[model samples]
Each structure stands twice: as C-alpha cells, then as structure tokens.
Target: MKEIRVFNNVPVLEDWMIDKQVEKQIRFLKAVHPQLTDIHWNEGRVELRPLKRDPDMKDYLRSYGAWHFNEKDVAELKKFLQQINGKGVDLYYSAFAFDYSMVVYKKDGTKYEKGKVNGENALFTSVLAADFDGITVEEFRREKQRLLDLDIETIDIFTGHGWQSIILLNHRVTDKEILKKFTELMTAKGFKVDSAIVDAARVLRMPYSFNCKALDKKTKYYDPVSPKIFATTDHSWTERRYHVAEVFERLNSLPDVIKQSDALTDIDVKAISTAPLTNTEKKAVKEKAKREIEEVKQIKVETLKAVYSMLDFERLPEAVQKMLAGSQEGLRNKVMMFLIPFLRNTLGLSIQTIKQIMMLWGERCSSKLDTDFVQTEVDRIYGLGFKGKHGHYTEELRKAYGYLEFDKYTKRNKIIIPNGFFEDMSTMSDGAVRIFLAMKLGESLDGVKNFSKADIQKYAQVSERTMERNIKDLLSKGHVCKRRGNRRKGEGHVYYTNPYFNSVAGFTMLENATVKLMLSDLTDGEIKLYCFLSKIVGDSRAECWTSQKYLANKIGKKGHDSISKMTGSLHEKGFITKKTIEKDGVKHSVYNLNY
Candidate 1:
C-alpha cells in the first residue's frame, strides 16, 4: 500500500509514517470531548488545508473548509485521511468543541455563516496548549526538564519542527480568561510559548497527519530525510484531569529565571537596616547600618525597578537616542520628526529648554544645522504645541517609543473604579490601602472564593499582622465587608471590597487608574499622592491645577514638602507631568496624569 525508496544506502518511507496514529487520534478526540456518542456526530470538526497566511487576502479561515465526523464514522474519517496523506496540505482539528447544530459550511468547501470556531460560537475547551517553534532539540530538552522540575505533566506532541505541550484539564473550561492566564503564567515560567493558541477556537495538527509545510523545497525549513509527522516519544498522557487552581498554583509556585536573577545574598537584614523587619527578629547590633541602607535602597529602586520596567525610557532604540545626540548626513529630518517631539511631548520639556537641547544636538551633527534654520524649526515645532499628528511632523517619535515593548498595563476589561474610592484611599493607612486594593482586584478577576487572608497578604505584599489589622480597619470603616465561615468546615473569612468602590458598572476614573495603581512600582506614599491627584483630576480632565498644601492636607501629610517630593518622584517615573504656573500672583502646580 506504501512506496519505499533507497537513497545513499538508506531506505526511506515515501509517506508520513507513525505507530498507531489513527488510534491515537481517536483517543485524543475522545479525551477532548468525553461525551462523544454514536447516536450523533461529535462536537469537534476537522479542518482541511487551513490557510496559514496570505499576502493578498484577509479572513483566510473563511476561505477554508472542515470535515465533521460522527462517532461511528471512524472508517470514513480513515478513508478521508488516506486520501489526503502526503498531499502537501496540513490537516488540523479544532482542539475545542463547537455547537454541532449551529455549524454551517458552503457547498464549495468554504466556511460559511457559523462554521468557523471562535470564542463566541465555540462551546468549551478541555485542553490548554502552548506551541514552541524553531527551537533546538537541546533547548526543548531543557524546557521539558523545567516542566519536570515543576511537576507539571503535559501531553507533549512532537509536531515536526517543534513541540506542543498540552495540559488536559479535568473539566471543560468555558472561561477564556482563565485559559489566557494559563499561557501568561507559562511565559512567566520561562517557557518560550506561543500565547496566541490560548483560545477556544484554536486548532492543532492532527496526530496522523503529515506536516506538509516542511515538504516544500522552497522554504528554509524543508528537510528531505526527516519524517515531519506528529508523534510523541514519551507516553505521558495525564490520567486525571487537573483542577484549574491546582494547575495555576503549580505554574505560579516557583520563581522563574527573571525573578530569581537577583539571588538574595546571605547578608543579614539587621546589617542592612536597624529598623526591625515587621515580623522577623534582630540578628545583631552591627547589622543595623547595613539593614538601613538596604531598606532605603530597596524602597527607592531595587525591588520596584524590577517590577515596573516602563520607567526605563533608556530602553528606547539606541538609533533614536544616537540621532538625538548627533544625526549623520542623511537623517536630519528624523531628529526634527522623532527626537524633537519625543523630548517635547514624552519628556515634557519646555520649548526654550527643547530649543537649547536641539542647538547642542545640531552642534554635534556631521554637518551642523544653520543656527537660524534650527531656531525656525524649534519655533515651528513649539508653535504646533506638542500635539501628536501635528500638521507637518507626525507622531513618529511616539511610534518609535511604542516599538520598544514597554511594560504593558493590563487591560481593564471595563472594570471601573469610582473617583470617590481614590479620595477614600487617601484617608486609609498604607497597609489597609494595599489589602483593600488587593481584595478589589481579586474580586474583579476571580471573585471571593479564591482569595483568603493568607492569599490577600501575599497579593498585598504585607505581613500577617498587617493584613489582620488593616482588614479589621477596612471592615470598621465599611470599605470592606466580610463573612466568616466555620473552622470545622475548613472555611475562612471571605472579604469583599465595597461595591461603591469596586463597580464593573458605568462609572469611570482615570483610564486604567485602578489597575496601574495596583500593579505599578509606586510606593505607599506615592500611591497616596497619586490617589489624591487622580481624585482631583477625575475622568474628564487631563491636567489639574492644585497647590501642594491642598494635596498635603487631602493626603493627611503634615507638610507640603512631602507632597512636593512625591510629585517630583511621580513625574520622574513617567506617572505624571508636573509644571509650575503662576496664576493671579500665586504659584500652583499643574499635574497631568500619564498612566
């Protein structure tokens, strides 16, 4: 039934060959949809020759077709598979199921109406898959070992060029967000994962099918001898479905390479700072100096720097920076287009300051700009008023910075915090503020079932006593309400942020203000300042005029100096733009929210 060839004294199979591939495909299908029955066609569909990409056309999936199968149609499925074997087109199957009755396809083998699988039409997914491509065998081995170390069991599919690690969940997951988070956590675990596949409608290479792309002689991936087929060397199929929490807990348990990069030295905390660690005891009197310095350093930069990488504006392209310093013969326009506006809008420099800087930049150029021309350019740019998409100079500077992959803020998913919440936050203690924010964020994400007091402390980055004390404070203040559960039932207090503060409804604060406040590296003091500013600024205004004395009083700070320092810190960190304006013989600071 199959042809064989001899080349260079080696016998090669002309067709894709694998052991028990048909049986394996059946088992995978059954595992994915456990309710498969002979009475009706199964939920999933088989895709034939799906378009990878097209230079001309968009919505390529709509141009493709699929084969629907019944439980008793294994022989027919086999016949179809045989017909397409080595036909130089990929065979794919939706990893998740769709509503069979609603499925539709055109007579010309193209998808019609509701035939394509997507988050809306697709029903549920039983497996979470991560695709890794173009990696070396040794690298793959290392990734496998990393998973082994984490005790994460996956059905590892060797798909021609790379591996696809699939985690078969114990139950079908309807929440796409949870599935999305799984891939994100995998990325944090140092796995080079293709995050695009974490969706309800994703497809994988059929187990019995050949990787037709690899057979193309024109492509760099073409291999003549290797059989580019879906096969697994280890039979590590998970026997039991893993609870979503259990899987998440395992993935989030260990610190990945980035987190562990700065291994804590054996240096005593007492040696770093004399101020006792809130929970731990003092080790030695001599450790006090070291402890204080370390604490100050940690508070100022070290820990927060690692978390909020967006502050590193230096990560902007070296070419862009070099252009600002000195443009070569052909690229003077780039400095005018990109660098000038970057300094004006992003850096928030005054026009005069920008002029002075540009003059210096011109001097450094190979062929220096004429003084009057430089002056005219600066005047024209300033006249345009730092607006993006300004008439002549486009927002190419902003675009250049965007390409740097700055630490992205999480999408709000329409969760809006009321402005009153920020005002209330200004009145609370730092520990209480963190705990309350954590609970609010937790509720927004998963709800009350998952976050306990211990979990709250971990998320809030506060101590046990801090959590207990502040949680009580929150309850007494009516900012948070808690319901206690029976200890005998292994239940704990479930706390909820006040609905007034945490509303998914139609209220709004500064855009992504809550998420940014929760996730940024802003200190408690800085957060207090930010909350106060955000409250004043509200949703409508971009900039607010307020005095430091007023801000200090609102934030419960005794001195305006603290407010000034916080404002300066916030401005330096790109959270806000602070400028002094003298209005009616009195000086006031204009704070513009940037997050």
Candidate 2:
C-alpha cells in the first residue's frame, strides 16, 4: 500500500551556480534493475491520468515508445500507487516533476472486514483514486491496522494535504457531506499517528527524503522544511506541492532505507542516522543555497526599483512595501531579479530611475543591488532581435510578480495603500468625501470610513485642517459620484431622513457635472446631512439599506434642522426635483436623487 503527498513538487528548485558549487549529481547506474515507476499530477479532472485501466500487459511498454509518446497518464496512476506504498515524499513544488499522485493496493480488497472500522471501500471512480472521500473510517482503520498487524508498529502517514492528513481525526470529518464518514474513522484509533500537512508551496530538499524513516512514535519529524523554504515570498503557491511519483523516483535508489544504529546512551539517533554529510560537506551545500538566495535577491531589487521609480508613484502600495521591508539585508538584490526586467519591458522605465528607486528600497527592500543583469534584461524587455517569441521572458516575469503580490496582499494584508496616504485619507474633513468613506466603512466607529461627523473626526484623528483639506480636495477632484436630491416629478421619495453617498468611478469625474454642484459648498453639519441624503437618494445597493438604523442611532444628536438645512441646500443647488404629495390625509415632501 502507498501513501502520497502531492501538494509540493519533489525537486523544483535549481541553481546552476549552486549545482556547480555543490558538484552533486544523480549517478545513474545504467538501469541497475528492472522496475516500474508511476507519475501523478494531483490536480483537477483535466489533470487526472487515464480514462480507464491499462491492460495487465502494459508492462511490455518500453524506452523507444516512452520517448516517442508520453504514457497516456499511466505514469500518473503509478505515481499514485508509489505514494500509497510510502515509497517517497517531497515537501515543495518540483519543476522537473510535473505528474504526481499516489496509488496503493490493499491485500483484502473487500466490502467488509473482521474488525468494525466502519469499513467501506466505496469507490475508485478516479483512474488513480487520489480522492479518498468515499472510503470509511472503518476502512482506513482496517488498512492502518493491517499495516500495524504486519509489524508496522508505527503509523507514519506521508501526509500531503486535505482530509488525508486530517485523519488524526478521520478522513470524512472534513465536514463536506461526501467525505465526512472517512474523517471520523481514520482519527478514531486512539493510537499515536503522525503526518505533515504541507503549507502551500513549501518542500524539503531531495536529501531530506531519507529523513522520512526517522518518523517515530516520539518526536516525529513531520514538517520536512528548512528555514530557506520560507526565506522568500516567491515560493508562496508551490511550496507545499510534492507529487508521489517524483518522491518515489527520488527515493528508489535506497533499500531497507533505515541507517545502522549504535545502541548508545549519549548519541541521538536523528543526528547521525544517515552518514553525516561531513562538516565541510554541509558548509558547501549551505553556501551554495545561500548564494542562490543572494542572486534571487539581486534580481528582485532591480525589478522593484525600476518599476516603482518609473511610475508616477504618488508612492508604493503599503502591502508591497511591507513585503519588501520584511527582510533587512540584500533587499534590493532580492527584489531586482524578481521584478526589474519585466517592469522595464512593460512600462518603458529608465534604468537611472531604477537606481534611484533601489536607493529608496535600501531603507526597506534590504540592500543595494548590483546592476549586472541590467543590459541583458533591457534587451529581453524590448524584444531586441528576437522575433519568434518576443514577450516570453516578459510574461514569465509578470507571472512571477503576480504570484509574489498574491502572497503580499491576499495572504498577509487587506490591501496595498501607498505609504503616507493613510495619514492624508485620515485627516480628510470634507463632509461629503469623509462621509462617503465612512458609509463605505459601514460607519466604522473606530475608523475613517464612518460617515457621522464625530465618528469621522475620530477616524481622521489628524488635525482638523488636514482632514478638511483632504475632504474638500476629494470633492474638488470629483471623487464623490452621485448627489442626493430633495424632489423630482417622476421620482417620488419613499423614505426620508438624510441623503445617501456613493463613490463614482475615479477617472470618469469629468463627465458627471451633478456631483460637482453637490460638493460646491458645505459646513461640517451640512456635509453629514447631505451625506445621509446621498445614502437614501442615490442608487445604493439594497444591502446598504440595512445599516440605516445603526447610522440614525449614532448621528441622532444632530437635530432635524441639519436635515432641513441639507434639503434647502440641495434644492438651492438644483440637486433634486421636489414636489408636495398628500399621504394619509397629510402633506409630505418627496425627494429624488440627481445624477
């Protein structure tokens, strides 16, 4: 039977310089023995292997045929099998190993078992059967116990991800109705079991595969990672992808894999389990890895500097700044490789400006970067002399940067606000603009997006003048879009208290003249009053209407006089068409929202 971890690639990272420095090679002994290898690409249906089972004679397949045509996903099925058999495991994405999943065989492949494990081996509809949802806890307990029964005393699950690892509880308990039964059964053993749920794209080195045998009932090493795996933001997505086939391929060389142990009291087994790679050896490997880290750093710095300086930055987004700032040394070098050439190609940025931005990044991005890749990068950026695929390198650089941004923004922070802009947005006092953000923040009592004047003031938390200037500035720049109105013939107002507010498209301000009139003049109280009207009058979404009670309770201190003042001001400004209507034997004024 096999257990597979297919999230991270087994052997992805490669450094030409490091490879040269380490001088390590996969010494193939010329097909030492006849064997079968499997490949798995643990992705969606479009990624699964084989439309059906291969005939048993599939063994007749060979070298020339393999070279001529890739096996029709037969490799994938094999990978699935290898992983289930606990052949090998990888903790990170391996570029070289694309197909990886696991396959396993149970000796007694039957519907029921002697021990009540809530046993059920429901289905294997998938050509490889990687999705183990239908299998019950009873089934897993039987499989697991079967291994234990065969002198497999310890349960060291080569965990990859999902419900498979959640088995410390049970497979089906992931709460998805389909897989819950399995979750309950796997975790019920009350036995010491161990697994490692890979964190996204992280993976251990190839040499570490030998470490799997170290898993024990005491202090099992499940997280097979080095500090370097988390050293940069670049490997965010593929860090945890290790395919079954790749691991099996990597570990196939060794047999009875465990290292010889000396029964001693003073020595720890893990430290010397495998022949210690001599101190000089470890140093050489670390140094090579460290150099690769430096090279990546250099490129990253150049890219960020070139791109940021060329843009009329107003400034860098906040989230990006933090990512760039997280590391203290080698900042520019790190950013340059990851970002520079792509920036130049995409935006036509100047190298001189790149240097200047690199300087800025020195304070945040780590250190100054060497300009070695500049010319080559520039040539690539401009598609100089190459006509076949002009933007291949540029596109790759873009994809890399996008992956970096996903980690910086979605994984770690809310957004990418420019530095110092927070102070500016906070101090904004224009009643309308401030009210607009306040409404947007859902009237945050603790923050700026709140609409009420007091809450706005609390949110601004800066000098009154500063807040007022930004609010007015936003008004003048036409940041606020829709203007609430007092009355209109066709638009009879249903509810009345204050106007509502809406943000218009930032670039489309020149087209909408009505909003300009609404922001022309206003006191603090008047601004809040009008903002309230904007909420009710403008075409706000239906969900927004739910918060009116919260707003009223907060802003009720301001008398209805504020409403009257706003209505009069809106009418005078030609913002609405108002008319008198009779309702339930009473006269009422109906207002409408102007564009």
**Top TM-score: which candidate number?**
1
lDDT of 2: 0.29
lDDT of 2 by residue, 426-457 (tens): 23444434344433333222223314334344
Runs in model 1 with CA error above 4 Å?
A: 1-20, 37-71, 103-114, 216-235, 256-595
Q: After superposition, how far is residue 406 of candidate 2 from its true place, in Å?
A: 29
RMSD vs true structure, all candidates: 30.2, 23.3
Decoy 2 TM-score against native: 0.22
Query: Distance from true position, residue 343, model 1, in Å?
Result: 67
Clashing pairs in 1: 170-241, 270-287, 271-287, 271-290, 271-291, 272-290, 272-291, 272-292, 273-291, 273-292
lDDT tens digits, residue span 1-595, model 1: 0111212211222323422555566676665544342244445453333433112233323313333335435655555555443345455667656664574555687664555565555666666777778786557656754664455556666565667777765455656444555666677678887777667667776544455554556667555677343322322343334445556666666677445433323341112221111111122223423321121111223432343333232333443443444544323554575556765554444454456567766766555654544655677666656575222332443332223331232223224456555555546776676665666555555445446678787667777887887777678778777788678999987666666644442344333233435445678778667766755655443577777888787777889899889899988876778899988998888888765
Candidate 2 ranges with C-alpha deviation above 4 Å: 1-284, 288-324, 327-546, 549-595
TM per candidate comes to 0.35, 0.22
